[model samples]
Target: MGQDAFMEPFSNLFCDLQCKIYFLLVGVCSALKLTVPPHTIHGIEGQPLHLTVNYNFNTTASEVQIIWLFERPQTNPKYLLGSVNQTVVPDLEYQHKFTLIPPNASLMINPLHISDEGNYIVKVNVRGNGTIAASQKIQVAVDVPVTKPIVHTEPSSGVVEYVGNMTLKCTVGKGTRVVYQWMKNGKRLHAGPNYTFSSNNATLLILPVVKEDIGNYSCLVSNPVSAMESEIIVPTIYYGPYGLRVKSDKGLKIGAVFTVDIGEAILFDCSADSNPPNTYSWIQRADNTTHVIKYGPHLEVLSDKVAQKTIDYMCRAFNNVTGKRDETHFTVIVTSVGLEKLAQKGKSLSSLAVITGISLLLILVMAFLFLWKRYQPYKVIQQKLQSRPETDYRKAQTFAGHESASDDFGIYEFVAIPDLAGGSRVSSQSVPGSDFISGQDMLSTVYEVIQHIPAQQQQDHQQ
Candidate 1:
């Protein structure tokens, strides 16, 4: 019975040892099932991104050891930092920039720079009964955040009507899964009848541009992480002159007359209301011909050139696009000294007036001379009849009787004939016995007497 008791104690001790071994094996199996494989960490190149290493253990342990390592493609692994229990120890090189807290199995990098990028390894050991080890490798990929996107238009300026299409492309330095949105006047725009968006949402197209399409436009670029906007761009649109009118620098003068004194220079301006400024040409009408003097909005004419009594000038303005033209006519009348000279001299007057006046004066003078000459012929006949005697009177009677049948004596008159012999000659005594008719028949008798009178007496009367 004493031997049996000693064997039972030893057997109990052996059972206790087997139970401990089974428990350790079970713990190992559970740890293998719960542990996670290594994974790569992702972060932006110039921004803070956390790197986490997850691990599992079968039993809760009071103290654990964690070590983090880093390696490049062709370089050896470098020890970064380690943690025991709740305390962390970091490599002197990166201690100030990188931080680690135990139990979390995570690492934080402040102001992550490009140099801290590569593959990382984490080794963990749980202290319970005997130490158990677990390890995982994580890859850290550092990338740069996308820079401010730029939107470029095919033709930076706006296009005219009936021109080709317009395109806007949004460009970013570095980004993934980007989206672009086009905005006009702070409103989002969608693809419509004339607008189309590209597949990647990076480009926007406007098929045709109309007058109403002018506005402030911008492009917005975004990703899951960040968004950026471009500066506003305004495009120029060209149009035409629709309504046109004239405006003079000096308001419209009465009758459109610009009066200036002699030797003075005057400026006349012509302006029209149009989309594009109109071209102007100054025209002057001289000697029945219209000529272009100058081309500009303003025209200056020296009064000395306008010596004439009245001068007329014109301004012609035209639109190249519409091919429409307008003209304004103005007259400058120089009434000071020019009109006076033209009137008094009468030198420049037409020929018709001069010819008519000379003709009337010549007719009046010729009538007076012819009337005076007609009486002379009658006086000579009267003198010849007064100087003859009775013997001649009978001869004259015979001639008178023959001519009296056709002569009208009532229209004839006579004055006494004067003696040419110093007023003392008795021509009356010589001719007293001859009966000279003293009536209308006297003129008939006188003409008859002159035809038959002797040549001696006729010569005495003519002397």
Candidate 2:
């Protein structure tokens, strides 16, 4: 009895294995085969849905049958429609919804709804070889079309650079499984140091606004069925007064210096790159003092009205919202450029070249005059006399006693002084023969007779 029980268990196991082998052979040798591409299919609400299936049989069949079933998760399959040869029979509840044409295993659903979204099972049965069957399952998903998205900013008015934060949120009216994307000037944007996004990528946050963050922004929402983009929106970002400069209408500008012609009216415009247009001020600096001369962007100055040859001016730009300021300094030189310009008309030689030549000529003349004056005999004598020491002046005064007589023996200048007796006397430390003469006669001597004395006779007298 024990050996019989063991044999009985082995027999049951052999039978079970034979049954499994029989079924496997049947599945492999079956003439009918069914193929359904794209196991998962997506469908839009209110749109026609098609589930495609292809079937083939090797043997010619007297009758062909195609059956379709619908099932949800953890639910029993429900019959949708079936076709025998060329005749279609649909379930009474879904007669108008499901459609299937002749001998084909594919099924169609018109105006598919959310409730119709489920797994679809198609079966093909051939009646020639005692009902050879093949089946395939396809999953269907229903979604509403993605609507156009709209973006809204936290502060609609504006935000200041580096002082305020900004937020952008995207919203959709109707959609399922919608994805969000941020775009700036037609390019996709990603999270950065100051930029962040929500989990669903619908909201964008700018921690601190800056000048580089200003641009046209938009939202793109898409689903498996449709895609849409919102209208462009520009966020106002108050920025600084950058690249400040001054421009003149009528002047020759070289770097920061503007050369203006005499009697010409020059208009200066102060400008800068900024948001919320900057307030401008024109300031004039002279004699180490500065004062605002104008409040507008434009300043008109006549060259004749300027008293100085060169004047310093400043252009200041201030942004009230951003609380930033920038300034530029320039110089205006008044010259007789009007006449020079007139002379330059239709002439190959520019006025600048003429001015340069004249300047060089003047400098040469001045140098020549300085050298000539430095080496002149008269100037040399004057400089020597003025630079003499005090003791030298005392020695010169003692020339009447013949002290330092050799030093005073060079050329001498003569002068006459009127005396109290109404006659003129020769003023000098000493004369060659003056000691032998009395006072009235000596004083009466003519300047011509004294000057006519020969150098030989003077030397002889000196010896």
Candidate 3:
């Protein structure tokens, strides 16, 4: 019974081994019937190249062997290198040109040349139960010519004249054995006298560019098999307003000196040739004070604000980039009214004295004329009376006297008169004298007689 048990365990072990061998045979047959395609490799001339080989093996093998072969057009294939398991064996001719890294089934070629362009085949063999073999091929191409190049400048546009340095660069797509050349207006430029090329021949530099240097520039790229030229590029430079001019703010002033009222304001604009606009300042020489009023192309000043009768004003223009400046000066004269006042003063005094004298003389003349006119009428009447001497005084008196007392009597008295023979002459009552009359006694008696005579004559005639 103990022997049977030991034999039973051995029998199970033997069956397991036989089954494992059967599966291995099936895997080897399957691997030998199929193959994995290889991948393509690409690289530029003078650059590193890497190639890969791909495959699969279904075998129960402890080790596998791989071989690499290289062939060019119109040439027979030759062994380049081989790798057994993890060990490598490279052909003597290609030992230094090619490298094989184990377990990856890949190859690397350093400093590849155009001549190295060809198809490479990798083969793999399995050494177990039944032998299996597979192979893959990859094609490689090399480029020895550079692609088109591009050129660029620092500043894009609006460059002023005569300024500073400028830099330009040239670059290529991809190439082997490449060379660069810089050209301006179809002429080749060299590194000398303010012109410089970069160490790698990829850049061109110009120091203190002037108006003469303005033109189209290009970068030329060349390789063994091809050459290319880049588009033109331009660099900008900024400069100056070398000569500046000054005038009134309106425009070119006709007169070099501007005349203005004392209490008015004036503006002066300064213009010049420059990349950026120039700065302006107004300077006035009055009371020995000098300072900046404002900054720009225009400067303003209030003339009346200045104390001096005659003042000098200057306009200055400056460019910060060019470190240059210019100036212009003008004079202003102020007038006074002193002379006009003096002339008017004499005329005013003379007019006042003439008016006063004429007024007094006119008053005296008017008084004398009024007095003579008043007395003239009375004198003329007296002359008329004296000329009429034929009129009797008594008859005139009777004609001018009152009527007889028999007419009517008021609360008054009357005297009777006789006939013309004068036997009993009636006496007439005398009118009483007014209070305004005052005279001597003799004059009073004459006045009484005069007053009674007219009445008495009338009464005598009536009788």
Better of 1 and 3 by TM-score: 1
Against the correct fold, how does model 2 do in TM-score?
0.68
Residue pairs with colliding backbones in model 2 are none
lDDT score of residue 312 within candidate 3? 77
lDDT of each: 0.64, 0.78, 0.65
Tens digits of lDDT, candidate 3, 112-197: 98888898877666667645565666887776778889887766554444556778888887886678999989999888877888
How does residue 382 of candidate 3 score in lDDT?
52
Weakest ten-residue segment in model 3 by summed lDDT: 406-415
User: If both were scored by TM-score, which would come out higher, candidate 2 or candidate 3?
Assistant: 2
Q: State the lDDT of candidate 1 residue by residue for 1-463, as single tens digits.
A: 2354335334434644554575577645245221333565556656787776577777667678777777789976677777898888777887887778878787788777667778776667676755556566677766555568887887875565446577888888877556788899999988898789988878888878654566788888776556788888765544433343233332224557754556656677777754246788988898999999899888776767765857888878786754667787888764455433344335566678778888998999999999987687577666865665644554443333333423422223334554575332212212323455543343565454445555654444335
Q: What is the TM-score of each candidate against the true structure?
A: 0.38, 0.68, 0.32
lDDT, candidate 1, residue 349? 61
